[model samples]
Target: AQSVTQLDSQVPVFEEAPVELRCNYSSSVSVYLFWYVQYPNQGLQLLLKYLSGSTLVKGINGFEAEFNKSQTSFHLRKPSVHISDTAEYFCAVRAFYNTDKLIFGTGTRLQVFP
Candidate 1:
């Protein structure tokens, strides 16, 4: 089984500023990681994923993440955040054996101010 931890519960940033939401995972076995974002009154939407190959993965809304095996971390970053970017973000891990189950971090609230 794998577990995910979102280092920050909340991150506030000014509009157009760069932002990073830290996430770390613990697992002896290999795992697939994902980042999802939820806007106000909306369900979680896929932001990016790290299955294999590339260490740097880009996703929707100009968000990107780097997979660091050495640090066991997959942190999400956006160079220029917008006020509309204010939302809740989650980090999830899926162990290869348990394809149907995903262990998710508590979540991080990104508050983008104008």
Candidate 2:
């Protein structure tokens, strides 16, 4: 069975501070990695993805992560965060095949303070 785990259910930080959201996955086969962010009362937007190459992947909004094959982990990080960055972040994995379904982690709520 394929599964994803988000270590932290929530993370709070002051504005303009650094932040990291941990994510781990367990899959029998190879999968595509993705990080999506959802604001309050809104849909999720794609943050980034690790498809085939490059261990380190950079995303929008000054966020980035490195895919650790040995550890089966992908952790998101940002040097400095803003209050507007407050939202729910989800890590997901999709099969390499044409399956549209994605297995997602529980999700991590990031609260950016002023």
Candidate 3:
């Protein structure tokens, strides 16, 4: 079985501060990892994804993640965050070359303050 773990349940940070949302996965098969964000009363939006190619994958909203095969980790990082960045961040993974089912973490709430 494959699972995802989010190190922090909640992260509070002042505006313009750097933030890193830790995520680690356990899988016996090859996997594709992803990061998604959900704002208050909004749906989940894709932050970044690691399908193939480079280890460093960049996505919208100034977010990026590096896929570490050895560590079995895909941590999301933002150099600076804004008040608008406050939301719930999720780490998900899907079995490579398999079903569309996605395994998600418990989620980390990013609370950005002024």
Best by lDDT: 3
Clashes of 1: 0
Query: What TM-score number comes out for model 1?
Result: 0.97
Which residue pairs show collisions in model 3? none
Instruction: Work out the TM-score per prediction.
Output: 0.97, 0.95, 0.97
What is the C-alpha local distance difference test score of each model? 0.95, 0.93, 0.96
In the range 53-111, model 3's lDDT, one tens digit per residue, is 99999999899999999999999999999999999999999999777689999999999
Off by over 4 Å in 1: none
lDDT of 2 by residue, 1-82 (tens): 6789999999999988899999999987888899999999999999999998999999999999999978999999999999
Residue-pair clashes per prediction, in order, are 0, 0, 0
Worst 10 residues of 2 by lDDT: 93-102
